[model samples]
Target: MFVSDSAAVRRPRIQSRAEATILHADLDSFYASVEQRDQRWLRGKPVLVGGGVVLAASYEAKAFGVRTPMNVGQALRLCPHAVVVPPRMSAYAAASEAVFAVFHDTTPLVEGISIDEAFLDVGGLRRISGEPVEIAHRLRAEIATKVGLPISVGIAGTKFLAKVASADAKPDGLRLVEPGRELDFLHPLPVQRLWGVGKVTAAALHANGITRIGQLAELGEPHLRAILGPAAARHLFALAWARDPRRVETGRRRRSIGAQRALGRRGRAPEEIAAYLDGLTDRLGRRLRAADRSCRTVVLRLRFDDFSRATRSHTLLEATDATASIRHAARLLLDTAQPLVTERGLTLIGLSLTNLDDAGPRQLTLPLEPRAENTLDATLDDLRRRFGSTAVTRAALLKTGEGLSVPLLPD
Candidate 1:
C-alpha cells in the first residue's frame, strides 16, 4: 500500500516555531526501489533483493508478510510471484549518492544515518529558504524528480519522533508531528516503537500487561527500574514521555566494516567452512582497503541450524588492511569456534573488522600496491574492477558460488 499523508504542508496549526524543524528523510525500500526504478517491469510488484538472505523487500512484498533478512526460500513460499533480483550494490550506491546530494543541497545540518536515511535539521532555514514543512516538500519533490525515487519524510520536534513519523508515512509520503500533541501521537503506539525495546524487552513488558507507550508512561521510573534494570528503566521512562534531546550530528566516522554469508540449511565439512571464511575475509579486506581504512579487530560470527548464534573475536596489536592478516585473524577465531560449530551444526558464517582507522603510512596494502601484500588479492581486485566481479574468482571458490555483495556508504 503506497500511503500518503502530506502533513508537510500543514494549515498553520497552533505550535511554537522551535518545534517541528527536524526532518527525517528515508528512502522507501531502498535497494528494491532502486531495482524497480531501473526496471520498469518491476514497479507495482513484489520485489525481493538478494538470492540467499533477503536484503530488502518492497512494500508490495511486505503486504504478503515478506521481510528483509528472511531466507529467499521462505519469502518465495509467502509470495510466490515476487520478483527475486540479485542485489546490484553499485546501482544502489549510485542512487544513494544522488539522493544524498539532494539532501546536502537542502540543508547543511544533515546527519546521514545510513545509505538510505538521514536526519536533516532544517531549523534555521525558514528565512533563507522557507518553513521546515515547505522545505521538506521541496526536498521530496527534488528527489522524486531528479533521482526518480520515492522517499518518505517526517517532520517533528525531535530526532526520534521524526524517525517514527517517517516510518508511519512510508511508500512516498510525508507526515508532521504537531507540537504539544507529541504525547497524543506517541502514547497510542506500541511500546516496541520506543528505542531499545527489542524482542526481549517487549516480551517482558507484554508479560506484565504493559504493551502501549501510555501504559509504560503510567508506570513510575522506580517501578520500571524494579521490572527492568536502572539503565533501561531510565532510558524507556524518558522516551515514553516523548523526550529525546539528541541532535542531528554530522561527520560521523564508520567504526566497523563487515560481511556475512548464509550457507543454507545443510551442514558443511570443516574444509568447506574454511573456504567460505576465506571468501568472506577476502571480500571484507578488499572493502576496508577500498574505503581507505584499516582495522585492529577481526570477529567471526556463526549461526547454527538451531537458529542460535555464537561469536568469537581476536584483536590485533596493530591495525592492518592486508587480506592475509585479516584472513589469519579470522581463521584463528574460527578455529576457536569449531567445537561450538560442530555441536550446533553450522548454517552461516559472518566476519567483521572493527576498530577501524584512517589509512596511514604504517598501514599495509595489497602486495602490488604496498608492503608484503598478497599479489593475487591485489591482481584479482584489479581484474574484477576492470572486467566485473564474476570475471575473476579464486580457485577455492570455483563451484562454491561467490556470495552476493552487500552495499555500504562511501566515506
Candidate 2:
C-alpha cells in the first residue's frame, strides 16, 4: 500500500565545520586480502578463498568477473588461472583483531559494523588528532603498516555519507564528503547506491522512471511514499538529502547473534544437513554463553538453488542459552522446513538466536541433582577455552565433516 507524509520531508540540516568528522573505514576484499597478505606469492594475483563456494575473491579475481559466494566451478570458468585457497579462520580473526586495535587507538568512539568495517567518530579530537581527513589517512597507513591490509576510508558529516564515501573509494583509497557538499556528491549516483535500494526497490523505482538518486529525491517524500511504501520511502528520501542522524555508537550490543554457512548447489542427505545444524547450534550456544546472553527465538534460514530463501522460527517456552535447548528448537524448525528443502534443493543454511536478554547468574537449586547437560556444556566450553576449539567435537561433526567455525567480530 502507498502512503504519503508531506510534513515529514525536509532537507538535511547542515553541520558546522567541527561536526563533519565521522569516518568509515572498510577493508578491501577482507578475507581474500588477508590470504594474500600472509602468502606474498599470491600478491597481485587472482585468489579465491573457499572450496565449494567462493567466500572472498581478491580484486584481481573481481577484475576477471569472479565474486564472493560464487560457485567454485563458475569462478574457475571466469578466471581459470585463479588460485583457489581454503579459508584460514584463525588467521583472519587475528588480522581483524589487529585492525580493530588500530581503530581503537585512532578514536575511543568506534562502532564496529562487521569483521572488516567500522565507523569512527573523531569529532572532538581536532586539538589532538588534527582534522578527520588526517585521522582517516593515518588510520589507513597504520592498518597497512601494522596489519598488512589495505583499507579504504571515507570522511563525512554523517555516518551514512561516510559509509557511502568509503564504498565509493574502494580497493584501497580515501574520500571525503564535506558538510555542504553532501548532496552534490550523493544525488548524481545511481538509486541503487541508496542504502535500502535493493533489487526489488530499484525495480520499483525504475518502473517509475526514477533511475538516479536525484530523480528519486525530486519525486518528493509524498510521491516516493506512494511508490515505495511508507517506511522505505521515508528512509530512502532522507538518505537522498543526506539527512542521516545516526551517531557512531561504541560498546553497542547486537540485537541478535547469528552465523551462517554456504553450501554449494548440491543434493545432500538429511542426516548431513542435521549434522551441520548441530555444529552451528553448538557454535551459537558457545557464543551466547560467552556473551552472557540468552534468546527466546531460534531461527533457521535456508537458501535454495534457485536463489530463493525461506526462514522458519520457533520461540521457546523460556529464554535460555543452553546448547541442548537451542539445538532442539533449531531441529524442530529445520524439520518444518525440510519439506521445502526437498522441493527446492538447499544451497545455504543459517541460524540466528533472537529476542535476546542477559543470561544472569544461575539460581541455586538445593540438593543439586547434577544437571548433566549444563555441566557438559560448561566442561566443553572450558576445555575449548584451554585446549582450543578442536578439543571437544561432537561425534556427528566428526563423521559429517562439519565446516570450519569462522571467527566473527564482537558485535
Candidate 3:
C-alpha cells in the first residue's frame, strides 16, 4: 500500500511556480462505508452492496479480490463470508448532500466529480484558512464529525496530481504533493496510474516494455505518437511531465445523461432488454425534466459476452426530454441492432441522451383535444415525484416482474 505522512512535509524544491492549493477529497468506499457506518455489526467486515452485481465493495471485500461491476456470484465466491446489502440510495444521497455542504463551506470553487469525490480550489485563503494542508485536515475532521464518513484528501499544485495523491492515500489518509516534488512523486508509479490508460492502452504500452510512467516519458512524444496515435500520445506525454492546466469548473452543465445495466453472462430475451431500456429511459427522462434540459440525440451502447462492444445512435429533429419520445427513439435504435445482438450474446445495455440544451419554457397553446400521452406523462411524473419512483410503473414492467430500478449516482 502507498503511504504518505498525514502531517505536511516539505521536499527539495524542483520547481518554483505556484503553491499546492488544489485539493481532491474522495470518500473511501462510499456506499459500502455508509453501510458499515449505519450498522454496528458490519464494521470491520467485508461488505458488498447489490445482489445481482457488485455496486460497491468495502476495503475488506476488496482485500479478497472483489470489485465493483463484477457478478455477485464471483464476488461471493471470493469472499463467501462477506455481508451483502441492498443499496440505500436515499441515505447515501443524504450523506452526500451533507458532505458537499461541508465542501462548499471550505471553498467556493468546488468541482464535484461524483457523489463521493470533488476537486476544491483554495488558492487565495491563506489569511482566512491558514494553509492548504491545514484546510484539508479540518475538512476531513469536519466530515468525520458531522457526516460520520472517512474521506481522504490530496493537496497538489494541479488537479490531476491532487486526484492521484488522494487515490494513493486510500482508505482514510491525507497526502500533499509539494510543487517541486510532483515529478519525483509521479514518475515511479505504473502507467496504469495515468488517466485514460485503460486495459487496451496498458496492453499496447506493455507490448513495447513501457510499463512505468518514467519509461513512457523516456519514449518521447514522437515514439508514443507512432505507437498510440497523435491525440492519446500528446495527452499522456503532457501528463507524464505533470502539465495539467484544467481548472475546477463550478456548476458544470452535464454534456449527456446516461444509464447502463449489467446483464451478467446470461442471454436476455428482446422483451427483457426492452423492459430494462424502459426503466432506464423513464429514470433518465425524469432527471432531464428535473434539470430543465432536453436532448437531440439518443445513443444505444451494448457489450457482448465475448467482451466486445458496439454503439448505435439516433438524432431527432427536435430536442425533447419526454419519456415517450426518448423511449421511441431508443427502441428504434435497439431494433436496428437486433441482428448484432442475436449474433453476439449481449451482456450489457446502456442508453445516453446527448446534445443537451436548456429546455426553456415550452410554448403553450390551447389544444382542440386532450392529448392522452402528454396527460399521462404529466400525471405519472407528478405521482412519482410526490410518492416515490415506484408509485406508478408501466404495465409491461409489472407483468414481467422486473426488479426495482437499480440506483445510480447523479449523471
Q: What TM-score would every model get versus the actual structure?
A: 0.89, 0.93, 0.91
lDDT per prediction?
Answer: 0.86, 0.87, 0.86
lDDT of 2 by residue, 60-169 (tens): 99999998778999999999999999999889999999999999999999999888899999999999999888888899999999999999999998888898999999
TM-score of model 2 relative to the true fold? 0.93
Where is model 3 more than 4 Å wrong at Cα?
Answer: 1-17, 361-374, 399-411
| Greater-TM-score candidate between 1 and 2 | 2
Candidate 2, residue 146: lDDT: 95
Give per-residue CA lDDT, model 3, range 112-188, as digits (tens): 88889999999988999989999999999999999999999999988989999999999899999987788889989
Q: Where does candidate 3 have its weakest 10-residue lDDT segment?
A: 1-10
Clashing pairs in 1: 367-373
The 10-residue segment of model 2 with minimum total lDDT is: 1-10
Ranking by TM-score: 2, 3, 1
Error of 2 at 123 (Å): 0.7
